[model samples]
Target: MKLSDKAYEKFKHHLMMGDLKPGQFISQRELATMTGVPLAPVREALLRLELEGVVQIAPQRGIQIVEVSLRFIRDTYQLRMMIEKEAAAKFAGNASEAMISQLREVHRSVIARVDEVGPSDNLLKDAQGIDDSLHDTIVSSLGNELVDWLYAMNNQRIQLIRLAHGHLTLITPGTFRQVMTEHMAIIEALESHDPDAAASAIEKHLTAALHRALGL
Candidate 1:
C-alpha cells in the first residue's frame, strides 16, 4: 500500500477499535505519530478523511473526529437501508439455493448455540461474523463498484456510530439472538426468491438497528 493509504487504514483501525475517539481533536503531527506514518502521509490521509466526513480539518484548530448525533445515526442508517434493501431484492432474484441454505444454517447454528450454552466471547464473535456476512453478501450482490465504494465509506461511519452506542459489540445475549432471528427472516425471504419480501425484511432489520443506534 502507499504511505497515505497505509495511514488511512491505520487511522480507521484505531477509530473502529475505540483507540481513537469521536469528537476528539488532534494535530497532524499527533495523528502521524499515532498512525506511525510520516507527517505528509498523515496530511494526505486527513484530507481523504475530511472528504468522507470522518473528520473535520480546520485551518488552525486541528482535526476533529466526527461526533455521533441523532442526525448522524439517522443519516447513516437511511443510506444503509436504501442500499441494502435494493441489494437484497437483487440477491433474492439471483442467489443460488445452496448459498441461501448455507446462510440459513449458519444463523440457525448460532441461535442454537446461544440457546444451549449461552453467549460466550467466542460465540459473540461468531455471531458478529454471521451478522456481517449476510449484509455483506447482499450489498456485494449489486456488483456496482461505485455503490460498493459508497457503501464502504458509509460503513465506516456506521461502525463508528455502533461503537459509540454500544449496540452491536456490547449487545446482550438475548439481543444478539434477536438479531440472528432477524437475519433468519431475511434469509428465508431470499430462499423463497421473493424479491419484495427480501427487500422488506432488509428494511425492517435496518430500521430496528437504526432505532437501537438512536436509543429509541
Candidate 2:
C-alpha cells in the first residue's frame, strides 16, 4: 500500500477506536508527531478523511471530526444487515461440519473474553471483534474471496459507527443483553443448517442492533 494509505489506516484506526478524544482538533503536524511519520502521508490522510466526510477541513482552520449523526448510524446498520443477512443464508447451506466446529471454537474464545472483561468493558471493541469472526466465518463458508474483501472494506465504516456510538450506553438492562440473546439465536439458526432460518436470525440480529442505536 502507499504510505498515504498507511497513514490513512493509522489515523482511521485511532478514530474508530475513539482514541482521538472527542472535540479534539487534528492537525497534520500533530498526526506526524504522534505517529512519528513524515508530513506527506499525514497530509494525504487528512485530505482523504476530509473527502470521506469523517473530517472537516476549514479553509484557514484545521481538521475537526464531523458530528456523529443518526443518518450515518442507520445507514451503517442497513448495509450490515443487507450484506450479513445474505452471508448467514449462504453459510447455512454451504458451511461444512468442520467450519461450524471452528466457529464454535471462536465462540468459546469470545465467551472467555467476556468473562475476563466482565461484560461491560470495551463494548464496541468486543462487538466488532465478534462481528468480524461471525462475518468472516460466514463469508469463508461461501468461498467467495471477492465478497470477503468487500466485507472487510465495509467493516471499516462499521467500526467507525461502533466507536461513534460507543458512548450511547448500549449495555442496559434492556439493550445489549437483548442483542446478545438475538446473537445467540443467530448461532442456533446456523447450527441448525437451515438457510431460511439463518437469514431470519440475521435479520433479527440486525434489527436488535438498530434498536440499540435508536435507544429503544
Candidate 3:
C-alpha cells in the first residue's frame, strides 16, 4: 500500500482500539509520532478521516474525535436495516453453494469455540471476521459497486463508533452465544434459498443489535 494508505490504516486502528477515544483531542504531530508515519501522509489520512465525519479538524484547537450520539446511532441503524434487508434477499437468491458453505463453516467454528476456556482475544477476532465476511459477501452479491462502497464507508464508521463505546470487543459468553445464534438463523435462511425468510432474519438480527447498542 501507499504511505498515505498505511498512515490511514494506522490511525484508524488507533481509533478503533480506543487509543484515541471519542471526543478526545489529538494533534497530527503526536499521531504521526505514534503511528510512525511521516507528517505529510498522516495529515492526508487525517483529512480523509475528516471527510468520513469521524473526526473534527481545527487549525488552532486540534482534531477532536467525533462523539457517538443517540441520533447518530438511530440514523445509522436505520440505513443499515434498509440496505442489509435487501442484500440478504438478493444473497439468498444468488449465493453459490461454496459461498453458503463458507458462511456455515464460520458459524460452526464460532459456535464450537463457545465451549472453550473463554472468549479469548482470538475467539473474539474470529467472531469479528465472521461478521465482516458474512455481511460483505451478502452486500457484494447485489452487484452494485456504489452501494457496496457506500455501505462499506458507513459500516466502518459504525465499527469505530462501537469500538469507541467499547461495544465492538464485548465478547462475554452470553453476547457471543447470542451472536452465534443470530448468525445461524441468517445462514439457515440463506441455505434454504428463501428470499423472504432471509430478509426477515436479517431484519430481526439488525433490530436486535440496534436495541443492544441503544441499551434498550
Ranking by lDDT: 1, 3, 2
**Candidate 3 Cα lDDT to native:** 0.83
Candidate 3 residue-wise lDDT, 119-143, digit = tens: 8878887787787778888888999
Would you list the clashing residue pairs of candidate 3?
none
lDDT for each of the candidates? 0.87, 0.70, 0.83
TM-score of 3: 0.86
The C-alpha local distance difference test score for the whole of candidate 2 amounts to 0.70
Model 1: residues >4 Å from true position, as ranges?
168-170
Write down the RMSD of candidate 2 (Cα, Å).
Answer: 3.8
On TM-score, the candidate that comes out on top is 1
TM-score of 1: 0.96
- Candidate 2 has its poorest 10 consecutive residues by lDDT at 167-176
The deviation in Å at residue 110 for candidate 2 is: 5.9
After superposition, candidate 3 runs with Cα above 4 Å error: 1-3, 116-121, 167-169
User: After superposition on all CA atoms, what RMSD does each candidate show versus the true structure?
Assistant: 1.3, 3.8, 2.4
Per-residue lDDT of model 1, residues 1-216, tens digit only: 999999999999889888888888889998888899999989999999999999999779999999988888889889999999999999999999988989989888988898899898899889888888888899998899999999999988887787787754345665796687778889889989999999999899888888777766
State every prediction's TM-score relative to the real structure.
0.96, 0.76, 0.86
